[model samples]
Target: MTLAAPTPTVPLNGDFWHTPLYTRTVDDGPAVNDALHALVLDRTRTAPTSTVGVRNADKTSSDLLRWEHPAIDHLRGWITDAAWALNDHVGAGRTPSGQDAEMIAEAWAVVYRPDGIHQLHSHHDAAWSGVYYVSTGHMQEGTGLLQFVDPRPSAAAREPDRTPLYTIRPEPGLLVAFPAWLRHWVTPYQGDAERVVVAFNVGFSRS
Candidate 1:
């Protein structure tokens, strides 16, 4: 048989090491908002004397409702969805079973009044963390925006044109979830109406 020449091939270039974020909206948003608004402002629920940054200015309940609260239950389901979405996005084909079940360690409500801000911090001792906006209030530019800092130190140097930070303006009934280790903060609120949010932390457990 006659010999034949091999054709040349080219290599493909693409992005790598991208972070995953999961966002969702509740189906019964209006009902959930009503329930959360009332629960966050419930006078009987004790607001702890928190020493965390700017927490004194914002209203917060120390109560971690694992069950019994309808809003919390709804949020629990949504967060679980976020976890599974993460499993699909990051672990697809990498592992046989993907991710395991997640355990809700704590859940609480936060109300940000004018000038309220949560200092830059990361959730410790949890695998996943998320926040649900019960009421975003009248949000304007730079008013109580949720911002996440890039966890990769080399990202900024690698992509100088791209900003190393990401921001999300909270909307009613909106939920945002991410890895617990990512550092994030809320910019000081400038609106007259109070901004309400429910936050939770989740960890994985073996069956």
Candidate 2:
């Protein structure tokens, strides 16, 4: 028998796809950031040139998250909660039992002076990555932007408003996190005052 005519339908809206991005403006973040800025800048006094990745910026150790300080301690708790929240998001609100497994982490505090920049890179070793902006510095627009390259290679060019690269103009207390494998970079810091952030990654403990 011939099938009946198919029913006509239209989507609720023109937008068809979505990507998950996690963000939060922290409570009491200003005070926490002030303490961290001083702590990290002071740490750099002994080693102002050392850096990691392709970053043209000064940074405290990649192990900065491991160090003990009141601000770091507060962030440690926040990061744990944030990572778990990300787990819930990825799981569609049905998080698996093992998803809450202990996390092994690496984090650092970066201070970008004028002309400082970080080239595109991804954390090949971690399952999640994040950044918490402490200071954006005295700068005009288009400076020190955090840009994430589009992950879908097969997609066609998008509208100008939907450029291939996703970017964020950082502000104090803003925290952002995403999959560790997503490639991203920072635009140059044109501001004379220092631009600061605490960047990090986390993966489940293997052992």
Candidate 3:
């Protein structure tokens, strides 16, 4: 008796338990950069912090979220817009009445001089986090890339294309947002110009 090979006819279905990352480029680029120079640049000169990071020489401003700086003030509209976008994304898998609550928790500026870097870390005690590139002068490879590592436990077993980490080259007037718990870092800058960014965290709150 000859046995015939079985044919598999059912279509395979798949779902990705994926992470969401958001990016936006400000339309009014010149206005945004002007504000950064007018407000943020001078403050970093005197208030550089010797705080948490790979480099002690890196100039990171104290939490500017609570401050009354004009630049910070100008970010309110953008921050609110970002929060709403996140809320919509988080609420996508839930019932309309069960949507997530989100708000900007805090913000600060980071200035990485040549050879400066921010070590790998995650934003704790928050629901979302983001960065706005105020000035990323002279875009070039290895000039401080913002990177995120895969949070999946299966990362070790994935293929090369599924490599665990990915990076974004900083550009002026760009904004990027992601989950707060995701691990991220900045590569050591090699350019002569400072890589300036405004980083912020978002918290969930009752409406």
Every model's TM-score: 0.78, 0.82, 0.78
Identify the candidate with maximal TM-score: 2
lDDT of each: 0.67, 0.73, 0.66
* Candidate 2 residue lDDT tens string, 1-207: 011111221111111125556677787898998998888888888755467753567877777776778998777766665566665556521225643355667788888988889888988777778899988887668989999887776565544456688778899898887778888999887886888899988776555
Please provide, for model 3 over 73-151, each residue's C-alpha lDDT reduced to its tens digit, 9 standing for 90 to 100.
5565555556556555555313357643334367777777777788999988777788888887675676688898888
Q: Which 10-residue window of candidate 1 scores lowest in summed lDDT?
A: 1-10
Please list the residue runs of candidate 3 whose C-alpha ends up more than 4 Å from where it truly belongs after superposition: 1-17, 56-62, 92-104, 158-161
Least well predicted 10-residue stretch by lDDT in candidate 2 = 1-10
Which parts of model 1 are misplaced by more than 4 Å?
Answer: 1-17, 43-51, 59-63, 92-102
Q: How good is model 3 by TM-score?
A: 0.78
* Model 3, position 22: C-alpha lDDT score: 73
Error of 1 at 126 (Å): 1.1
Q: Give candidate 1's root-mean-square deviation (CA, Å).
A: 12.0
Residue 50 of model 3 has an lDDT of 58
